[model samples]
Target: MQYVQRADRKIVGYEETEYDQNRRNSRDQGKKKFSRTMALILGVVLTLELMIMGAMLFHIDFHSADRIAMVFAFAVLYFGVVAGLTDK
Candidate 1:
């Protein structure tokens, strides 16, 4: 966290601001594992994603626009959300 100290409140002559760097930044927070909730979500999402991939890969009537739409929806919704899933 960063904090700035302003001593002068003048409208025309603004003094320099002091910043504190002792606190850690928000981005430097500790690691976050794939929680149980996320795991459950991943399981369901992965199952459907794999099924779609199999259908598309094996050329098993995966030509429908609906199928393509399913793929796009998964990418837009779940896959990106699970991108932070880590083994450790």
Candidate 2:
């Protein structure tokens, strides 16, 4: 357990902020593993998407609309994953 000492050098009982910070720290420690896993997955997905986009462009099938869609989709998915799993 972690603790904070007050200005007077006395150990203060856990305040709400301290509790929240500790909770966030613990949660983030666990989520480090999850984050690494997700990073691996995202890397593969992004690579595949890039390959597909490249192939489409090579075939002259790429459109401005497709690029826009891909950008927006990637942004939304990235934000959704991060925000959905993050601790306050």
Candidate 3:
């Protein structure tokens, strides 16, 4: 049970059942897990992409076109994943 008071001095009582609280807690946990997982994924992907670009910039002997293509592919894939995540 909870009481909410308005600025006008009106009082309102609300009942929060245990089941409701548990369900809310579980939902929050799920969202946190999802966000963490997505963050990890994006971080790894971005790191790898940066490393590749850095290698290319330093003349690492990789074919220029191929390296650029790979970077572009990764960017597209990342955007797709982002779209999917945001769709939820």
Candidate 4:
């Protein structure tokens, strides 16, 4: 594989060997893992937001109170997804 970079308005080419590809793949995997982690965190936040909104609408109703469990549930799921995607 070969990669080209623009330096000083000129194209510079570098030969990418198999080892380079492996390293690049690892780096790309890291990026993917980070994105997934962010997405999981966002999901948790959104769940909490929805739960809060629901509770407000219900005005302390029992069914709405049940949604409070969703916050912890979603948090666990978020961590699980992130941990599964990332390498130890």
State the lDDT of candidate 2 residue by residue for 19-64, as single tens digits.
7888888988874434656755765576567657766777745464
Give the Å shift of residue 14 in candidate 1.
30
Candidate 1: stretches off by over 4 Å: 1-24, 61-86
TM-score of each model, paired residue for residue? 0.35, 0.31, 0.35, 0.33
Q: Is candidate 1 or candidate 2 better by TM-score?
A: 1
Clashing pairs in 4: none
- CA error at residue 31 for candidate 2, angstroms: 1.1
Give the alpha carbon lDDT tens digit for every residue of 1-88 in model 3. Answer: 7799999999999899999899889988876434757765875677577657877788666564487776787677666666665455
Error of 2 at 57 (Å): 2.7
Tens digits of per-residue lDDT, candidate 4, 1-88, equal 4657676677777788889989989988865334655666766676667657766886757555556685576667656655665545
Best by lDDT: 3
lDDT of 3 at 20: 81
Model 4 ranges off by over 4 Å: 1-34, 61-88
**Best candidate (score: TM-score):** 1
Q: Which stretches of candidate 3 lie over 4 Å from their true place?
A: 1-11, 33-68, 78-88
- Give the Å shift of residue 64 in candidate 3: 13
Q: Which lDDT tens digits does candidate 1 get at residues 8-51?
A: 75335344334323233434555456686777687677768776
Candidate 2's TM-score reads 0.31
Q: What residue pairs clash in candidate 1, if any at all?
A: none
